[model samples]
Target: MNLFGYEIRRKSNNTASNLPASTLSYIGVPPVFQGSTETVGTIDTRGKAGQAKAYALCSPLMSVISKKCAAIKNLRLAATTEDGEDLERPDAVRTMSHPNGVQGIADFVAHIEAMTQIFGKAYIVRMESVGLPEAFELFVVPNLCVTENAAISPALSFMPDADIVDYTVTICGSSMKIAKEDMFIVRDASYDLNACGGNISRMVSLQKPVNTFVASYEAVHELMINRGMLAIISLTSGSGDIIRDARLPETESEKNNIQQAFRKYGIRADQFKYAITSMNAAVSPVSSTITDLGLTDVQKACKKEIADIYQVPSVLLDVEGSTYANAKEAKTILYNDAIIPEANNIFSVLNRIYGFEDFKVMPYYDHLELFQESKREQAAGMTNLVNALNNAVSGGLMTTEQAKTELLKYIV
Candidate 1:
């Protein structure tokens, strides 16, 4: 498949109808730097997406954040008037409840959110039938490249809606272009201009921590395979001089015997084995240990940094030092700070695309038990304040207007 004049090969064994071939192929090198030549740095969109996907698959912390944020299933589109009053759900809003025939609203939005988090952007295609205006389908494009129209002038280049012409979507080694009006894009904040303000993937900034995490695991694996070698053994004669190379082994069988002895009788094993040398040689041990490398501390620090970059609470990643109270609070923070904002951003763009003037579709979380508990607590506090104000007015401690003024402060 060709993307921005670059060719990407498809894997030969990828026969699954549901999977995109581009996803299975090696990451393509971007044609050139997207933004201005004077820009300080360049971003490779495909390469970055590939790296992010690998990290998300390898690192537990990153995987947790991506899954936790995308696991939100309580989202619903609600219609409301300009005066903040609830209105009856319109047909457009009802259609969004199950955007496509296969996936419900929750699953559809979850897929979009997951892709956006991993690839820094997601493209949703609007499949409208010829005569059925209300019967439209929505599905995410697995791999896409945005192409700008040549007709757009330099003055209006920053306006993506007008500047973008079509999206080149690659699927199963085939490619097609979708018109701009039929696509909805959700992306993180971007500073790039040449690529229609495409976002820089968050994984680009987390390379160091992810590499450290992987390296630490590799070191442990190597140590286990080597049978935990802790010291370098040296042989010396009884004269306190190193044994000469000529005196060591003269035949292949002798060399193999020495190697076998060392392998069998090295370090602390299930049963202690002794090496018997007939030359009256003395052995010295040069000590080394994995603890001296401090890999555990390094691994912990890397996990913490990865979680911080994704705005995930560290308590969720590592429950060793977490209490029940703090764990609950951390979950609440994750939902309020990361998940809800992202859901709103996607749905708000959908509302604008449908051009609903009488009502707007939005996601609400009042049904969640976490927020429900908070509401009950708030209601109790408000009731106590109202009773206190009433008692003050009845006891002549304060005038009715003064009590009302104080009550307003709390309500607001």
Candidate 2:
């Protein structure tokens, strides 16, 4: 017997009465009681699955965000000294190595980037904790553990009014339960305090724009096909009058022969004009003519909308009106505004897990030398300040030390 689309009873062996009392009670339980304490987690990944597929196949914007964010450098563990100075620790770097083969920081960043891009949040699980100063490996798990993987049990030791405080995660299709301390979670922006994990994807609010881009892309291809057809050939009547055939083809063979003839000489006027002339119709030469669809500008607009969704400069996508100098400025802005924040958010999670107070993962784009031009301009301004300070010192208006102090204000 089937109940609610599930087999509740099968022959004499598997029946509802044979199941546990707890399992039987779940059949009529309200959705609110499905999880503990009335707080529910968002576990459904269908949206994320669609987003991932789109990122993989339909668009390059997600990849651009992920790859650019993952290209961080100079991230290392550091320790704070008694003098309040931060010192990089090489020993700490080696501890970051994964015991599950050769995966390292790069692989970690790639997984994180992809997770954040598709799901808007990520969780790094520590694989083991067996030694002093605990050398452990980190791996990512699905974001929806509370809903998709395990049930939440209320920690009864808490006061009645206190929140659930902690959760134990269990893998589906398994019997083991994971301790709370083994997981480190980071979430994107959310208004709900009780939300298990929240994410704010760049494309989340740009659904309309994404649809427009896709539609415009398809429309452009269709327009191109029509344009190609019009460019290669033309079809016209001897007169702009409709031909009415009183006696149509009575057999399939006759119809096919007529179709073959039309396919051969119907499109090009030069091929069969004499044959039409031999009939009672006067032949007029017809050729393809260009029609303006203004599709180029429309497609450009659509591309710009897509770039805007990711805060990426359209020039990076080969959009027009983007100069080299402006593109350079855009690249700097892109790295500073969008990419760095994401890298910082991921690092925050790592810091919390490793209990590091002095170190952080920072996005490094200095190899691009984005600040060099600004530095040059600053140097020029500083030179003028120095020359003026020198004149003041030479005129005895200010002492050398005083001039130095005045110069330091602007230079520093």
Q: Tell me each candidate's RMSD, in Å, in order.
A: 8.8, 12.4
lDDT of 1 by residue, 1-412 (tens): 7653467778555354445633332211122211112211222324644555454444654565565556466775678776667888777677778877899888888878766766677778999867998667888765334443444454555565555556676555465778878888888543344465667566667666665666555555445444334544554545655545225666999889878777676445763466566655555544334586687888888878877777788888782489889888987998887778888788877777667777777888777777888999989999999999899889999999999898888773
Clashes of each: 0, 0
Worst 10 residues of 1 by lDDT: 27-36
In model 1, the Cα lDDT at residue 75 comes to 71
What TM-score would each prediction reach against the true structure? 0.72, 0.61
Which segments of candidate 2 are over 4 A away from where they belong?
A: 1-46, 70-88, 93-101, 129-133, 142-177, 189-198, 215-239, 243-302, 358-361, 379-384, 410-412
Write candidate 2's Cα lDDT for 192-280 as tens digits.
Answer: 23343334555565555444444444444344343232322222244434334234467999779756776655335565632342333
Off by over 4 Å in 1: 1-46, 82-84, 90-93, 144-156, 161-163, 190-198, 226-289, 398-409
Error of 1 at 42 (Å): 16
lDDT of 2 at 202: 52
Error of 1 at 48 (Å): 3.9
Clash pairs of candidate 2?
none
lDDT of 1 at 202: 63
